[model samples]
Target: MAVNLNDDLEFVDDDYFDMFEFEDEGFEVNRLRREGNSAGPDDVEDASKQKSDTSALEYRKGKDMQGIPWERLNYTRDKYREMRLKQYKNFQNLSRPHHGLEKECKQVKSGSRFYDFQSNTRLVKSTIVHFQLRNLLWATSKHDVYTVQNYSVMHWSSLLQRGQEVLNVAGQIAPTQKYHGSSPRPLSRVQISTMAVKDNLMVAGGFQGEVICKYLNQSGVAFCTNLTDSDNAITNAVDIYQPSNGSTRVMTANNDSYVRVFDVERFVLLNRFPHSWSVNNTSVSPDGKLLAVLGDSTECLVADPQTGKAIGSLKGHFDYSFASAWHPDGRILATGNQDKTCRLWDIRNPSQSVAVLKGRMGAIRGLKFSSDGRFMAMAEPADFVHICDATSDYYCTQEIDLFGEIAGISFSLDSEALFVGVADRTYGSLLEFNRRNQFHFLDSFF
Candidate 1:
């Protein structure tokens, strides 16, 4: 759009395009002067005459709200039209996708099964899964949803519950874009199976796309450029990684071909590593030295992140290595796949399988090693999250029904807690495993 800080200003949006008129400048001055002269000097009142003049002035002013002189109204109109055109152009420029030039890039299908890392031990029995959607993720609250555009407010007093009795409520909500930002928040970006939020930052990584680092501001919601595009240096271009620590940092993963360390605030890319196939998932090692990347295309390669050389290819899963994880000590790597079996590999020798975890027939997608590295939690395509002994193969001793299709699961930093994604809602859950080793619903935050 055109910028005019001067008295004469013009702004145009794309709503009306072909209506602009073209005229040279001198014509505008002469025309305005002519209109001024026709109006004559202001006759201070002949009450009736003044009334007529006032009426005419009001009508004229209404036609020139931008405050441009009557004759220049046409020029202003054209300026507005041009402004609109420019805005449209600007939108187009921003909408175009930047072929992300993440170094050593490889493309992979986003929902590939290569993200789960399972452990079979004599530990637990089952696990849970949650998180499913239509508009993706705009966490629904109570009986209503906060839409993308309408950040409205509703009075909390507005309802009731009728049972053998009845239900009622009070108050109402007023939805408006008033508190909204310059753009509508995206309902979804790449499916970030895990979103790690710490302090003011939220890091997401999952879908076979870019990991996004979202910086929160005082805005009504979190602040980040979003899935659309990046201007002014904020966006979803970086591959995000959330180590056990809550601090948010984005890794560089473009396509699936390469992986690199990325600094969120500066958008700087560093420490690039090439992958043999498109990466299904990137997990930071518990020790923080290794980055485990699960790949599916043809050969799945695991390499020393620092050296950028292939350590070896994990061979076990028939179709693809759907899920994998590194032991806390960083000595072992475990993988789950579409065939419904989980394999354990020793990183020192990736070519051999030390153990096989089997049970379910469908995909086993979620995996977690207890903070003590003594127990493991694994979830299948079903509703259970299984707790297993990490030392022994497939040694599940207990289980918990997450009550929905399992999407993701994790043990908290202290192993005292577990988070499971609920399929029917956008917001996942925070469940605590008490000393009795039972899962407790953490509903206080709700």
Candidate 2:
């Protein structure tokens, strides 16, 4: 076939060789043949055909894994990343300066700025299932607070920056004594409806017409007694009072239409006063001479603590009253009513209310006054608490948004902090607010 190699290898233009090349239309067949499919002309074409089929199968398989489309998998990954980023942003927002911080200040209508301090949200793990906070009290020591929910009394300590549950006193019935004849069964459960704390003593009244007293520093119950004949009776309110000349006493208002006074030392029934309607709340005067009582009626009654005699009545509320608070000087009284208003009464003028403070929503359920007689706080059923300045005729005020069912409110004995109790399953908390003032003259005197 090759007679003379030099004669066949003649010089030719490079453009002439380029014109003889073929364009690839199917899977670059000739390139695959050169790489691995080296065979005769007919076999080469068949192998190229088979390789093209396999390449098409692999291309389709690359579009998905485990029957899911590539587009869908990318979308799921993007969504998860977005959710995680959003969660991180929310956590960062909580740490920023907001209304719930202790040093945050709010501007009032009068252009005066005041600081609204809030502690960390406290959660009672054991009482999370209960949706109602029946009563609340601040201990003589300003660092502790108590709450009554269902059959348990919870003690919260605020010694640290954040408040936490320290102790819980759960009610239990005593075993019946052996008797010759048949005896009735004692109550198996007692639901505490009201509570009061003084010094080391804690007294709670139950819905089963029972009163249980316990010592805060001790373990066991101090005393337990059934105050009413019927088991269905409710103790609406319990108050601890210290007279000037006598020892400490406990006063209770019950749904059985009676107010009873008990000696804290002896746990004996001292006196009982029968009222026309069920008493909802009662507060003894600071002088220990008169008692301010609120009941089912619109009028609030002033009674003698020693004799239980009705001295006079303060009228003017449009609806039934639920809570009452007395001024530190014993000259003024505030009664909260279902009419969404709190009425202020002066003992000197028993015929009419001195002032009426309105709420945004729901009835007024709780009332408290600072020990210095400077501020008065009224709590509505849900989402609102009003702190009014008593020195200005309650004209200057600040509203605190709690955003839950408010069970009770109390001011510290030193007039430094205010405590609010929220009674919700998910949002239940004890909120503590500090009073920030620029002046220190009164603080030095105290």
Candidate 3:
């Protein structure tokens, strides 16, 4: 199957046409090696390792933690960055002038150091099934991270410097507990497209519209089902949030132009919201009163969470939106678009956006707000991840430069660490950045 672009998989770009071509060969080699002994993504050692020693978090100060051998690649870091800027193409469904909002954006300065680079671990290679979907990585705490690696959902630990398979969808999956309104048959060879982890509950959405829910503390699959049977039925996004009623819910945005909410406890369908366009992503407000829906349309809808009624519409985006995030304060909403921009909107006045942020290259595939509401991280499709100061109206930012396609960006629940997943075959690894503060020294003492 081809990578789904434009929500309906109607558009295809050459950049990602050969993405899945290299997976089968790699998977077969790794499968045979795993039968003999345990081997992770960090098991390989190349001649470049003799040049400079690097490991997950075992490097001395001032050493290159990423271990990228620019000399071997025959291109300097600066030269490659320039090449990507000129050659990388941003996928777009609509041909519209992009310079209109560029004038309104402020010249964002990039010297701010809110988070400092800590380490990079090749122990777990992050992979994405869909090129446009990027919510694959999730950090439950400063030490634990969950990401997709081929056919398995792998969990990596910064403290242990090792990884373990959490869920494997390479075979068949059936719900452990059956409930009403469930699929009768089990799903085999499921390919996960998007995932979200929160409050000990992890929900993964597949390309075949399969919703698989698992609890980190529990064993085996908690619940699993195929959400839609349509030919174009792809689960684009999954979000787990607790509303004001204190009940846990899972919301899935599907290419079938519907957002389905499920009760977590019973694993039963609660409500379904219909949309005019394919819903790429949906986010409920922190208070659980409002919902932000983005998809094939340029405008994002702010609706009542219960009824899914359109209370307001945010206009100004030039292309399709793939990501949406809400601040903890519940007043600000950030939407990422294929137009290579992320716009911040104020809920009180939905007439226009408060700020417009541009990307280095490619589209803004993911947006994340720190749990403390202190910072916001925006990720492009590759190489660049921007961290902005949410308290300062997003004027100051720190651009993290690396070489790889970004699988996802996630902030730890405590807001102490930021994790970036690189999906490249050569530099495929997980990068870590610790929150910079005066109390950081206290961690060493502990």
- Best first by lDDT, ranked: 3, 2, 1
Using all chains and alpha carbons, the TM-scores for the candidates as numbered come to: 0.48, 0.68, 0.88
Q: lDDT tens string, model 1, 1-446?
A: 11112211011121212232423223434444566754333322232222221121343336221112436445554565454334422111012232322221222112211112211110111111111111111111221111111111111110121101010011121112222222223333223333433344444432223243444333232322232132211111232444444434455433335665654445344466765544444556655556666544423567655555765677655544445667788887776554555667778877767766653324455566766787666666544566666654444345553322343565645554444433322112222233233222232222
Whole-model lDDT, model 1: 0.39
Report the number of backbone clashes for model 1. 63
Q: Evaluated with TM-score, which candidate comes out highest?
A: 3
Q: Rank the candidates by TM-score, best first.
A: 3, 2, 1
Q: What is the per-residue lDDT of model 2 for residues 21-96, given as tens digits with 9 covering 90 to 100?
A: 2232234456656676565676666654343221212333452111122253335534533543343211010122
The candidate with the higher lDDT, 2 or 3, is 3
lDDT of 1 at 320: 43
Per-residue CA lDDT of model 3 for 231-330, tens digit only, reads 7788999999988999999999999999999998788888999999999999999999999999999999999989989999999999999999999999
Record all residue pairs in model 3 with backbone atoms less than 3 Å apart, i.e. clashing. Answer: none
- Model 2 Cα displacement at 350 (Å)? 1.7
Q: Estimate the overall C-alpha local distance difference test score of candidate 3.
A: 0.83
